[model samples]
Target chain A: MARTRLTPEREGELYAAVLDLLREVGYDALTMDAVAARTRSSKATLYRQWGSKPALVVTALRHNKPVSLAEIDTGSLRGDFHAVLQRTDDCQMEKDSALMRGLSHAVHESPELHQALRELLIEPEMTGLDELLRRAVDRGELRPDNPALKYIPHMMIGAIAARQLVEDRAVDQAFLIDYVDSVVLPALGV
Target chain B: MARTRLTPEREGELYAAVLDLLREVGYDALTMDAVAARTRSSKATLYRQWGSKPALVVTALRHNKPVSLAEIDTGSLRGDFHAVLQRTDDCQMEKDSALMRGLSHAVHESPELHQALRELLIEPEMTGLDELLRRAVDRGELRPDNPALKYIPHMMIGAIAARQLVEDRAVDQAFLIDYVDSVVLPALGV
Candidate 1:
């Protein structure tokens, strides 16, 4: 493979192209050729930069995620959660959800993709959420020994994904707030 | 099109073939030709009976689901949930999860399949769970006006699905019980 040096902007364009194709055709149907054609880049360049479709898709998803959760301190756990949930730009959320839905099947079948998703996308966000929750524990807003703590990410993120999958509904801020107030907060004994 | 009278046993065989193929190849890669070859049935017969791949896959999934939630009364809400969660035959659960994972991507892209899944598979289970929760409310185990009542199905089912998707873990009886005790019960203020 010929090595190609891609600028940050060029890399972003490739990522966008991959995500667009992912949403349009899904993981199984998407091809490196299509991504290269869409971005007007050679397939060799894409392969050289990302190595494979799963690697490219994972990198794309990671690129699209919020860079930092450090700015999400709202002093209270509920406020912080609501802030984080609402932090996704509305336009981006639609695309991200579509990309996520598109990747769901492939992720299960491919261990490499699944591991990359956990390591690159989910783990980082989870680490951020965990940090926020720890701050709440420090503030006496929650019990340190609460078993619910282990499942908070599952509950909140899962609820959103489940609502979308089962009900075909978009999870708006109102729904997130209600979820936090009624389900998450109560589970935390707040 | 050749008119074929499929016996009950023949229909079961067809459903099994579809699900098995779905697990092995996934929804995108699964083909009517493959199903026909697997079941030793004509492609014309499959199309005549199920109309399309999505239709056949959805029918197969619906056929595999537990037929009745009527027998799930365990007197207590927690017991009922545990019973329902554990209701799937263990061997079947593995196959079903694989099938579900395989269908995840297609479910989002195909509205007809999505609607069929919600109506045939999800709604029925949600109805059963809702009925159980109502019984709990009547027994004064939970408040009728509690906001968490609206999200019980999402919480329990979502937590299980989320665990599988994110953590790649089997949601066994012990995990469900702990989830109920820690997350669901606390969320419901029990």
Candidate 2:
């Protein structure tokens, strides 16, 4: 069956199941058959709806996001950055960090998965982030050619990904807000 | 059967084999039996020598590093940061990035692996980094209590890890050097 056939409630359940399976087994080990078994759906139905494992997995990941970065406009870069964090529940960051790490390796091995993830997930988030920076630049808050501009994603990702690795700490909102104020904002001369 | 009894050349080869197995498979899927088979050594010797899978893997990971961060004192934080990269061959950075990404996920699951990796691998790197930062602070090049002091590792790690994920680009020594100049120094007010 098509994805639209499912009610919103059914759709939410399926997406949650897919993400949980991904966190447990990773992309290489995850199978449409396993997804089917977990969701009590048929493999053909999944394949029919999403076209491939990568598409299905990426769609589920997208659905998990609580807010879109593109929609945020708080009139200041600091406000936008903090607002982005405000939208994401504090508890979700740790699990999301773990999930991204789990996929980081898998992304290296599968071009389709990488493409799907970027196109569906990372690209939009990046575009939204770029827009936020653009607005800041428009307001004369940042230089147009700051080399650090390109590295915002890297810095943010590093903060989220490296926190657990280096310090054995969960990435709570408090840490991220501080990170933005002390590290990110200063580096950008904001 | 002890690792001490092996010739230095043989020990290096065994360590190389262990690292190769780790890269091809991840920590959880990797086995002592696989390491033994790959290296043409007996599993008993492996256990007697390294004690466990996590220990053997961590030991091999340590052996692959070309420089010890603690041994480097370039007399300045920037010089030492660049020196650390100088010691690591540029060609190896991409592979090391992938290996770390691979391990990042597994590190979340296995406490033994986490302990061994932090104790054997990450801790020394942090210490060396800390020494470098201390030298910087002592020289009055940076503020003693700068919040960004703790984030150097996270920033550097992010630059390497997120390059491929975000930009689909390989991180070379040149890229790292530029990162040090652009993002890192400015953040530190250096």
Candidate 3:
């Protein structure tokens, strides 16, 4: 329904604006009024289009993902992983990480937002990632029952979340690439 | 210093109160006013003891750790890892995880909180973890030049942080032990 209401370029612009506002004002402080004013749209239009702030924010995040992991089959799992890092630049990754850190807290308090995030952003990526890993197993890279398989999502998310807590740095391309090459690959015996 | 102002028991009571408030209301909404009310201390005394809310909260988290990872030396890395998990009950671990999740977002907005968390909670744990890993390497459990060594913190923290995001569950001891047994240990070639 929303897709039909706006042109593709206009929808892209609206999503970008939503994310920019989210970065400037956190989820708790963010309001529909601010989103409308920033995008020069009316509150009614925003409500009609997104239904709610949580859904809007989650949809924007889904729209902004640099690459869908499902589309990444580079013939090698390592190559696929590297391809993910290459799709987004360091600055974008830092912004995305910051946005995610902000969202991580909000999700705890609001089940609706959590549900939207899982449906619109997290689950889709996870599905794509599942396929990526399954292919690795299919290629004899990792045993099907490799216990590490279940924990890959945790390791990937943690790599970003802990960087700020541990080293006080953003998860850049180099650090992530190194993590994949060293920690993830070695753990998987790839 | 704050240490001299109160007995250890009283100081711990105050820190426990601080953490309770932090979990109930996130860092942004938590205030010295609420803290003083909860602990039956004056606002002036609260400031006198901890200097600021961020400092006080970070100190509380440090005080609440179930076990200091640095003190763990169970003759092997596996033993030490398991030892780290045994010190805390699952309920407490879930609480700490929630508390940490609350603080994770707060640290993004407040440099003071971020600095205090790193200094009080993160750096100390990291120092202990570094020694633990070094001991493992010394015992020929891993190559000193092993690339995975650098990312162990990432993996460890990631496991906890990612659990909620990926699987929507708390990090229980059973799951954590298995993670260490399967993912972390295997990654290190242990």
Q: Per-residue CA lDDT of candidate 2, range B1-190, in tens?
A: 3667799899999988877777888777888888888888898889998898888888888988988988888888788878988987777887787678778778888889889988989998888778778888888898988888878878887888788888888889998888888899889988
Candidate 2 residue-wise lDDT, A26-138, digit = tens: 87899999999999999988988899999999999999998899899999999999999888877788778767877887898899999999999999998898899999999
* Chain B only: TM-score of model 1: 0.85
lDDT-best of 1 and 2 = 2
Task: Please state the CAPRI-style docking class of candidate 3.
Answer: high
lDDT of candidate 2 vs native? 0.86
Give the residue spans of candidate 2 off by over 4 A. A1-10, A37-45, B1-3
i-RMS for every candidate? 1.6, 1.1, 1.0
Better of 1 and 3 by DockQ: 3
- Give the clashing pairs for model 2: none
**Which pairs clash inside model 3?**
A158-B158
The 0-to-1 C-alpha lDDT of every candidate, in the order given, reads: 0.79, 0.86, 0.87
Encode model 3's per-residue lDDT on B38-151: one tens digit a residue: 999999988887888888998898899867888899989899999999899999999999898887877878999999888888788879998998898888887888778878
Q: What's the distance in Å from true for residue B47, model 3?
A: 3.8
- For residues A53-131, write the lDDT of model 1, one tens digit per residue: 7778898988876656766898999788778778776666767777777777677778888887887777877888789
Cα deviation of A63 in candidate 3 (Å)? Answer: 1.4
The TM-scores of all predictions, comma-separated, are 0.85, 0.91, 0.94
Model 1 ranges off by over 4 Å: A1-10, A29-52, B1-14, B28-56
RMSD of each: 3.7, 2.4, 1.9
Error of 2 at A57 (Å): 1.3
